[model samples]
Target: MSQFPPPLRQPEAERNPLPVPRPMSGRKVLLAVLAGLVLGWMIGMFMESIVANTPNDIDPDELHRLRWLLAAAGALSGLAIESIRQLQAASTDPAYRRRRRFRP
Candidate 1:
């Protein structure tokens, strides 16, 4: 006599999974890019304000350097924001959830 119950069988359709989801549409990509740019620009402006309000004197050369630094910071922040948006989108996707369930 078998001590354990037999394994339940699932339908063929359930056994064979569908292909992974396709890439994001162009519109979504564009939107994500635009959102990131806006966020980065806002942060850059805030940083500039902080620098402007400092008590110490700032030289013309220092001001030029600050502009470059601010630009780079803004670009990097924009990239980070875009990545976060992508991550959130993926997490909420039903296909993504299904794929995750099958992963180790």
Candidate 2:
């Protein structure tokens, strides 16, 4: 019998051979959501004001619906913008390099 014991298992990083995703912090997520909410609220208020001042007559229900739509659009835009920024940052980060890295 050999005197030496069996070799220990390789580390997970070496064994997996896959790049692990860096975890995002809660603060970043919370800030993104807050930004979206604020943008949505501001857009809603602005649209409501414009609708209120329009010369042409609009139905009350229609105006309310329009306001909600505008707010929703703004919120979605904010979220999209935040996501893009995060993705860009991640791609540029020096830690991990992949073949599909984003350009421009």
Candidate 3:
């Protein structure tokens, strides 16, 4: 019998061990949400001020709709920004790169 014991099994550290994402820090997520809300509020106030000063009168319903639209846009933009940051982090991480898509 060979003197050497079976080589100790080493865990492979190639790529993402699990596809499912683990929970991230809630504080960071909360901060992003708060920042988005503040930005949305500021945008709403700025739009109101602009509309109030405009020479042409806009329908009240239309003005309300515009405000809502702008707020929604702000939120979506913020989400997109956050997603991009997450993607960047994943791309740059060596562990993540192992699992990311490969070029042919």
Count clashes in each candidate, considering only residues at least 3 apart in sequence or on different chains. Answer: 0, 0, 0
How far residue 32's Cα lies from its native spot in candidate 2, in Å, is: 2.3
Residue-by-residue lDDT tens digits, candidate 1, 14-101: 8965555455455665566566556656665676678779987767577656666666665566566666666656564555555444
TM-score winner between candidates 1 and 3: 3
State every prediction's TM-score relative to the real structure: 0.46, 0.53, 0.54
Off by over 4 Å in 1: 1-11, 14-16, 59-104
Candidate 3 Cα outliers beyond 4 Å, as residue runs: 1-27, 92-104
Q: Give the Cα lDDT of each candidate.
A: 0.63, 0.69, 0.69
What C-alpha lDDT does candidate 1 achieve relative to the native structure?
Answer: 0.63
Worst 10 residues of 2 by lDDT: 90-99
Q: Which ten residues in a row are the worst by lDDT in model 1?
A: 92-101
As for candidate 3, its clashing pairs are none
Question: Once superposed on the true structure, which residue ranges of model 2 sit more than 4 Å away at CA?
Answer: 1-21, 92-104
